[model samples]
Target: MTDDVVSALLHPIYVRLQETAVPAGGAGSEYILFFSYTDGRNRARVETFRGPTFADAWHRGLARLRKVVAKHPDMIRWLRVDTVDEMRRSNWAELKRQLTEVKRNYCRQGISLDRNCRHAFLETEINANAMFYGGVEYPHCVVNEKNFRLYAKLRHGLGDVDLKDATLVWMFSSRGFFLDKERPDEVHEIAGPGRSAGCRIVEALDDDLLSKVIKSSSTFLTGQVGDDGRFIYGWHPCFDREIQAYNSLRHASTTYAMIEAWEVTQDAALWAAIERSLAWLLREAICTVTLPDGTEAAFLVDVGNEIKLGANAVAILAFTQHAVVGGCIDHLPLLEKLAQGVLHMQQSKDGSFVHVLNYPDLTVKEAFRTIYYEGEAAFGLMRLYSLTGDERWLSAVEKAFDHFIAKEHWRHNDHWLSYCVNELTRYRPQERYLRFGIENVRDHLDFVLNRITTFPTLLELMMASEAMLARIEAMPDMRHLLGEIDLSKFHRALHFRARYLLNGYFWPELAMFYAKPQRIVGSFFIRHHAFRVRIDDVEHYLSGMVAYRSKLIGNSNRVRKAEATV
Candidate 1:
């Protein structure tokens, strides 16, 4: 597997170099090889190798790489080759000196070069190169790295653990490497056969393009759902190992995204897959219980023992979307029961909800799991409110919003909250909800615009916020609020994020670099995480694309129609 990955990564460089006038091997004919290897988990190793030729440099680096690969047999390997002139022009010497200084500092502090030390070193290396394009004439980061890890650590106190959950981005034009969290995907593609042939530049995220992406990604996800309605879950494609773990929250949310995709493709096969998955969820995960008050409730049980608040919320989202989109209310009874289960979790005094409960007996297993559950529960309630016109659901969300506003939940930039606020304001337009919607995404514009990872939820949040903004724009009374916000920058973030997320999509061109490209060609991946393709990853990306297609593209079409009428 290591040899295969190494060979795949090297193949492209070999092909590109063959087209160049450079000789294969000679004195002072230097080649710089950057190698990245990961176990698809916590451990990763990156290094730079220089030699008279590509094979020589790879052979030299393989000795060190073999040690890591032996310990972690399931590994993803990436190699980038550059001429010594490119490295020199990109100021690689200065960057090497800085890295040497950092190592010395660690040595002075008596810090052994252990896992944490290696992680920090990787951070320092990535931070130094993510954004530095050598010059306009050269038009690429010659050194092939970025400074985002340092930026995120300094700005957000993002430590090694948090920084480890990152994705890698290769600017095909400049041969520079990037972490999705630190840099935006937009960059100058110059001085390469990849760019010169006009093959690497991504197309605009227009209606047609978004429709295609949404369909294909959803289709890939649909393929993961089998006859028994169980998802293949995900894959660490480096070794092609199917992820053994399953989360009910991810399952329900993925179903919700499939329904959203159904709105676009209307493919009957996809719908059939959706039905099978929902049937599996209902049969295996959901359980009906009678409370002390005699109200029947449905809870999504995971591993036959635990029930998560987010799971119930997304179950509501999935079933409600299924009911409305499929025009089948058979899930009505189940949906109502699900809402009752959610209400059971909510606190009467403060509207805060418990995050996890042990199933059957219904004891508190966890008080708070993640902030995402709060918004998801609210959004689920709001979505149910939209479907049934039930004030009970709306009132519950309102009470939760009271808690959210008091706690300043907007700082989390949660996508679910954005969805809830948008839905809430649509039915009952109010100042507080409007303000929350704006604040939810306003401060994160720079982060969203610059983000390199597909990081799907950012798009979902932006789309929901944009919808609220459009609603506000049309309201005579709320028009004044736009004055306080940079509407132009907000739009720019929306447009930029819509297009930039393509970096994570497994297009054939990119997937061909990985093992078993056929299985992964239409899915989304976390580049730094050994290009992991999980059900949730695809769900988030597909959901974001669906929202973009329906909201942004639909709005542009309506505007164009309005102009034509004028």
Candidate 2:
């Protein structure tokens, strides 16, 4: 293994590369060096040094590349110590130019499903000639804290670019090799042919576009479910391949979303996937507890012997929702068990639920909590109560309001309370729930409306809008909180937000760059560092859009009825 080059991968050095074209964070310079070459056959190869200025990163990258460099061994070679800034800029310009040509030649596809006509891509390779370029340029990313450390975080897509510290990245423009975490010994390469055109964001709101994005996103998700019902965690868009990661909490959320999609598109494949994922969750992820009265309750859990507060909450909601949608009471037993588990966790004093239950030993821990779990736990109870017509859940819900409202936990960027409030309003018409939900939505909307520079994520926009829209639907007087903006603008914002999803929703098989094209889409990559697309990313997007859409359709029906009466 100590064959210098191969050994270098095991041990890498750290170096500070320049960031000219793509912006950088606090220090401005990024880790890892870009190693690239074009072989005698005129095929280009690119990779990265593993560590910060590590000599091994270069040696290891070059060693695998030897197969190509050896094949031709003689070609018009271009090497550089320069940054990717120039190429990134060039690629952007090249893509725009190509898009313009396609529009002229192909009748301007104009931001619709017709965009699937050609693949749009951006490529960036390392510049070896640092003297000529004056400096090396880094590619862009919404860096995460742990990901920027070249050696620690590596993936197959965007070969050598930084996503280590990225909050979220919508588009990646490169082709190179990335490492698979499960198979650390094997290096996976993502290389593709030059793509044809580009994408231009359409600012105008369109319902048809919203439906298209939802359907496309649903299709990709359905393809990700395994025969065992487990959904694949992440995907590298450039390679169109799955990464090795999984989440139990998301399984329930994805099931909920597929059910929502089934309502809109009535696609059988989606329902099948939902059924599979639900089976997988029940079989592998649930932890059962036998309470004091000898009654058993089930709770959903991720890995480790711990039960997450939110996981159980979402599971209960998903089970209940699925039962309602599928028109079956078969899951009621499991739903009751899951709800009891959540209910048992609540503190008698403040109505907050337990955050984690470490199993085997069954130790309970709730010292501190994140911003959203408390409300999520409460919402789960609300769903169970609504389904069973039990007021025990109601008593817990009001106590939760007493504690959480005093703490003002709803002031932040979570949709837990807003969603819970909206749902609870259905059975109990409390103005407090409606008003609190409205204030949260209005404040966030006001923030977004006032900001002219940046736009919130499609998920966030849909969430706030859904809450307000739901409120106005129940109580017309609340429409004033939306200010001068109407329902159509909210719809437009949702349609536009789909443009930045952490996915390439088009048919990947049509793209020349994808190594393996699958039938589904991957999303929710906004949180993690790898080419990650979590279930929540797809779930939240689906939930918000579907909610608003149903509301809009209902509103339209009411309007039509009123006109007929007049």
Candidate 3:
């Protein structure tokens, strides 16, 4: 048989086999014929393959049959076989066994973190990409080709080497990769799969080409505009397009970065930029536009569709505190009105704030939100009360704290609980507040000193409690506790908290910087016996730094220290 004739015969046979099915319990059979003609030399071959399951052997058999038919078309034509029932039965049995083995292997592999029921289907594309390409570049990291091309032409000739590695190198350098020695392991691990692919496509005389490519890539910081109607930050190529405005993680990050800049630089221009961004948030980003009652409602959204109650509270703190500190009293009424409305949303039936509120419309009943909202809301209310001295605000703060005490919810005494206690202490200077503060501190210390597995939570709690204590001592009545407490332990805790908050990869350095003045004041109070006489001085400094304040001062170091001893 000619090779061409054999090939024609095999094509129909292959097509027919694809439609065939076998019985559930049967072994499968398959056949193939191949004919090769090189120059004048001709060859013919036939093969049969078997397997424990029909699905497995049937596929292999079909492949073999195609090869055979390609080699011996004359033999197949002479046989005059239209369809074979015997072959079909054998093929079905083999296929079944093959499918069974596949099922068994899948069961044996079990579930992995990346392949669980919940995430498996959702991450299908990501998993496939990881398997095929190792790592995917996030949109933020991808360089804008338009800007890079223009920049390359202006700075350097359209040389392939300079332009090729420009974007990649820029990205790496912006991330502090070159300056910092402790590069994350994920960097190399993620780059591993792409290394060979990258090498094949691009070659340079230098081995450091890959590193240079990353360093030259553009960053997100460049394109940010300030309130002064000028490009305050440099332009980033990636941000050229309008990012999704609603419930966007990127927007939240931008807000956080601006807040951090305001804290660090204490620059009015930065603050103005932050105010502009907040205006954008209020005008456009808020999810709930109008309530059923015709009132407008709004809430903050963080990454992962997460509604961040704490963020709203923080925003209120920033704006109101800024107005007060800047002596912009004209803005105070507007700020106070906003703060009151936010506090109303934060209040829980139990008098504490919920951790998060899910009303995208920001118009839902408080019953639907999480308990954590209360913790944040309480803190916000306390700040408002401290600034305005409104009895209603103070009462609200008291009710929130009493809600926790009434419920005896000590389990929540992790970091957030510590924050709640701290906020309450600043608002309420009674002996009970001080005692409760001590208890919360001891709880945190016990958890940390015991070396519990949940040590991070414990450390945060301890630091929060210590910070609370330090703030409380800024008040006259509680100044005595400074002498009774161990200052070294308090300072260490403050340092730990600052470092932990600073180490967070996504946000700005506000948390770290904010903790510094508190730490310094705490340390000073511990060291100086004269602090008793200068308690007013301490209070004045603290009031300037913190959003909350209390008025009162200790008379003498000996008297305050003696009171604490008793």
User: What are the lDDT figures for the candidates, one per model?
Assistant: 0.69, 0.52, 0.37
lDDT of 3 by residue, 1-566 (tens): 45454435444433443344222112223221111111111111112233444345445644554555466533331111111122111122333333344311111111111111111110111111111111123211122345334433432334332223222121000000000012212111000111111101122212143122111111112124345322222111111122223333234334433443344346555466556655665554445434445555445555444456655665455555555555555645544544555555545565755454454544343343545555555665566666777777667767766776776655556455666667666656676666566665654443344331212344445645766776766778777766655666655554443223211111111011111211111211210111110211222122222221111112245568899999
Q: Model 1's lDDT to the true fold?
A: 0.69
Query: Which digits, one per residue and each the tens of the lDDT, describe model 2 over residues 340-429?
Result: 787777778887667888764446865456757777887788878888888878888888877777777657746777767766767766
Write model 1 residue lDDT over 1-566, tens digit each, in one string: 46555444445445554344232212325554444433223223445555666567657765655565566555543222332222111123444334343321111111011211212222212322232322234322332233344433543355632212133221111232211111222222212332112113554568877888888999998899999888989997644679999887799999999999999999988999999999999999999988879999999998758889999999999999998998999999999999999999999899999999998988999999999999999999999989999999999999999899999999999999999999999988998889889888888999988764557788899998988999998999988777767889999998888776776776543443344656786788765354578999999888888888888667798999999999
- Which number leads on lDDT? 1
Each prediction's TM-score versus the true structure: 0.71, 0.61, 0.41
TM-score (C-alpha, index-matched) for candidate 1: 0.71
Clashes of each: 8, 36, 62
Worst 10 contiguous positions by lDDT, candidate 2: 126-135
Point out the higher-scoring one by TM-score: 2 or 3.
Answer: 2
Segments of candidate 1 deviating more than 4 angstroms: 1-199
> Which regions of candidate 3 are displaced past 4 Å?
1-263, 285-312, 346-349, 353-369, 414-420, 439-441, 445-464, 471-491, 497-566
Model 2 residue 262 CA deviation in Å:
1.0
